[model samples]
Target chain A: MERNNDVWVFIEQHNGKASDVSFELLSKGRKLAETLSGSLKSVVIGHNIESLAKETFRFGAVEAYTIDDQSLANYRTMPYSRIVNQLVDAHKPGIFLFGATIVGRDLAPRAASHSKSGLTADCTDLQISDVKYLRVDYKNLLLQIRPAFGGNIIATIISPDVQTQMATVREGVMRLEPLEKPGIGKITKIPYLPEAFDSIVEIIEQHRQENKVNLKSAPIIVAGGYGVGTKENFRFVEELAHAIGGEVAGSRAAVDAGFVTPDRQVGQTGVTVRPKLYIAVGISGAIQHRAGMQESNKIIAINSDADAPIFGVAHYGVVGDASQILPLFINVFKQKLK
Target chain B: MAINSIVMVKQVPDTANISGQVMKEDGTVNRALLPAIFNHEDRVALELALQVQDTYSGKVTVITMGPPRASDVLRECLYMGADEAYLISDRKFAGADTLATSYVLSEAIRKIGRYDIIFSGRQAIDGDTAQVGPQTAEKLHIPQVTYTEEVLHIQDGKIRIKRKIEGGYEIVESGMPVLVTVLKDAVSPRPYKARRVMTYKNAKTLMELEKLVEGNSLLYIDQLKDEYLSKNLYIRTFTMDDLMLEAERCGVAGSPTKVHKVESVVLGGGQREMFHATKAGIGELIDKLMVDHIFG
Candidate 1:
């Protein structure tokens, strides 16, 4: 084991509540810590966030660093960056992982800059390489896999020179570690100085829209793609989602068409979801779209073309018009519920 | 008086495409095998910045951080109506992520001297980190507006911009010397002007013309660099030495992030059993979901 041995995962939180991605990172971080002969640690930053830290221990973190300050409540780039920066410098960790959420997207880069570390964003896969001591061979490297080329290909990247390897994994890509035992993690409170925090940019107000759906945590997701045809056809997907008591998701194509918001998008450019049941309607299943939802427990694809790429990874493939098939499925489910 | 804007652009490898053999197992992307071109969203961002330059009666300078091959985007920038183009290319800047990248770019921006605005795409498709703009802004200690979809109006040293939010959008107002990260919908970058392409075709980075001049000759590399600098044509290539950046604080040595593992997940849908419409069956279905921890 190295002298400064700790595996730290940034437990991303919003509005004093922890994001599910934090648990996912903890799941993966636990394995990485074991491989490197280190202990798992988590950094939680927010106001009144001790409860979130308690949850971190249930998911494999042995020690949790909590920076609970009023200024740290809502995520502003500078303050959050400063806090994470302070922690990394104080406790040198072998690896720092974050969920590539909106807050993570804003904070990770700045933290990496402050720490002078390399960061790979939106990675789908992460692994440590076992390399022999110096002799010029392929054995010594940490391979980081991410979708590239607009999601057409998966690139395995390695950092052979850096000590602490950092990456931002997409939300829902990894399953959350079960909370079998009560949390046995110790919490350390970092001193905060409100006077030191000064942000040139202020998040004036966060407007919560009426139709806001937490797609990241949705259990049942019915997603649409380009094959959903025109913008009007997307309604069928929404109907299906409503029938199944789930939220509506869209491929990058549907989001680009303005049919749905980027938050509801399911793909490399959008949110990664691991719902209990994912019904991909009229989606041809580009690797980019699949990168986001391929982790779902069950994938049911409805496309007119049987040879559509979506069917390749789908657990159940129905070759028919989504406009027609969705309504049928919705009616059947409704009748069954009745 | 209007403000001058300089946008730093780069031509990254189309990293989205990754076959096991894309790197030839040699760690370098096979250019012939893989396609190389200007970054798509960066081009659009350049266009948005150029539009501001045209409206405000100022010059737009395009800068890129890459090898001599990156000169292509520089030329393309010139054709797109940029007043000047610079390429910051050096061996030390290779394999840089957003952190190291911002360091090199900030140095080049400093060398270029004065500018009111810095424009960059929200993120490059290749590395979707979206960190460079904010990081550069942080290093420069300037205000930054990210995910900007439209530049509403600029007047009296105050810049009004519309930035994309989660559900909708928000209008933000900032003073001059602000770094704006542009979204794809901001403005469509214009096509290259044919005349400028013809005139600036001879523009060359020191490394580009090094082959003809040889390792040593009447034209010293430093002197040529000076000539370019004097002509305002120098790309302001900076090494770790120029930035006074400690070698340990740059490149892979400086980066502490690592990948733990990689696995491809294949989602499979579960069994679907048609349920009877009776009251007992309806109650049972709801109970099953609750028991499974999927719903309650």
Candidate 2:
């Protein structure tokens, strides 16, 4: 066995709570580690994050290496990156994975840069494969698969020469496996060293947006496209969403046309969603738009155009104007639910 | 100090019209089949740089690394109000993943010298890795703000930027020499000025002039380059030698990530059940969705 054969997942936490993606990474990391016949470890770095490290056992990690410090509480890229870089130098793990969250995107590149390693961003799939490049045979190389060319082509990338294969997977791409029996994992506390130049950028104020709708985790999503017309017309989308107890989302066109907020946008440039039910209203079903929600279990598309592209991935389609169709849906749900 | 901005742009094959033969076996794109255009997000990045330059009275230099045809985007950048444009093209630079590409770009930026801010698109439509800007910043040992939507203010060597997060936007202030990756919707790219287009249409890179002189022996390379330089129509060109980049660290050789496979996904409509826009049709959809446990 190689000396550094451990798979490590960076556990990201927000507001002192571990992110679901961290658990998802543990579930995924366990499989990769098992394939390599190595132990699955997780690195949790933050203030008062020992509890979160203990929680890693439930997901599947065998060892939780922690660097808890007050300065690490809020994510400042420099300090967080320095800790991860030092951790890599100490442990020399073969594979490192991070959640493709804002913090991950910011910190992974910095760490990869510091380590002089390669990092793949926003990976959708990870697997173990034997890859040969030139004269060297890379055994059990981590295959990182992601969509390229605007989600038209899935490109599998592998870091053949780098010691640490780093990748960041988007939220909800991997499933979180909660075992019936909690596994026992060792928690190793790493002392934090106060480093100079910890942070260059200072956060004056940080707050969440008012009424932030988490469309990614929403079970049911009612999305409107540009065909919905005006910003006021989006009220029909909201009414229908409220009627069915679902979140209101929009296509890129709808967001760009001022009919919806940027956060409500659902597409390649926006957010990827895999809800249980996705009802696309007035969407033309462009490939960029479908890339996000095609994974939904059930898709129902309503559009005035009978041959709109949205019907391609949808299980059910209605040939009607969303303005008229959405109101009808709202009325029926209002009467049926009551 | 007035902002001296450099905008990194890429000429990406138009992804909207892709068909089956989109990717080569090695995972670099099959660029011949599709038409190329200035990447939409990079155009916005250039527009943001131009806006900052306009406000602060500085210079906006655009740089791109691609094939000879990539000079097209450099010309467009000039027509769109860039004070200068550089095309870093060489055969050894092909098949470069984000890592190698960022290395070469960082080297070029270092050679380009004075610059206060660097602007780049969040990601290219071709690779969509979104790693180059951040990676370049790391290589240059500077700070970077990705998914930036607005530049709130720049003063006293500190720049305040509003960047997009998952659910909201965050305003961050960083010192000068920071890299910003702009979003496509950050701002509407201004149209090329008709007069600037005519004036810069004759702009030619060194390689381009070499080709021109080779084709027409009537004109000498030295005199033609001198005339173009006098007219401010000669786009700056850099090769690997010009940047003093190591041959092994500039292209495919420097790229650590190797392509394993390329799969093209085509969304199909075989399972779609069409409805007739009637009252019964709406009711049927709800019932079917409920039965499938998608709704209850």
Per-residue lDDT over A1-338 for candidate 2, one digit per residue giving the tens place of the 0 to 100 score: 25367999999986678887889999999899989999999899888987889899888898999888887887776677778888999888989999887778878877777675768887877999887756677789999987766555677888877878899987767788976787889999999887566666656556575546688889999999988888888899998888888999999788878888877778755678988999999888765688678889888998888877788899888888888888887776655556
Give the CA lDDT, 0 to 100, for residue A156 in model 1: 67
Off by more than 4 A, model 2 = A1-3, A131-138, A226-236, A252-258, A267-274, A282-291, A303-313, A319-338, B16-30, B165-171, B185-191, B266-274, B290-296
lDDT of 1 by residue, A1-338 (tens): 23344678998776777777889999988887777678899998889998888888888899988888887786666667777877888787768888886667767777766666667788877776664433544432445678655454466665555556677888777777766775688998887766433454555455545436788778899999888988898999888788778999898778877888777888776777888988888887877788888778777777787766677777655667777777666665666556
The most accurate candidate by lDDT is 2
* Predicted candidate 1 versus true structure: per-residue lDDT over B1-296, tens digit per residue: 68789887868676645444765443434555666678777888899888887788888888888877888888788778888887776676666667777877877788788998899888886667788987787677676778888887778887878776644666667766888888787888787678777766767776665764695577677777777667655544445565576565455444444323323433334444332334444345444554555544
Q: What's the TM-score of each model vs. the native?
A: 0.76, 0.88
Candidate number 2, chain A TM-score: 0.87
Query: Candidate 2 at residue B101, lDDT?
Result: 90
Question: What global local distance difference test value does model 1 have?
Answer: 0.73
Docking class of 1: incorrect
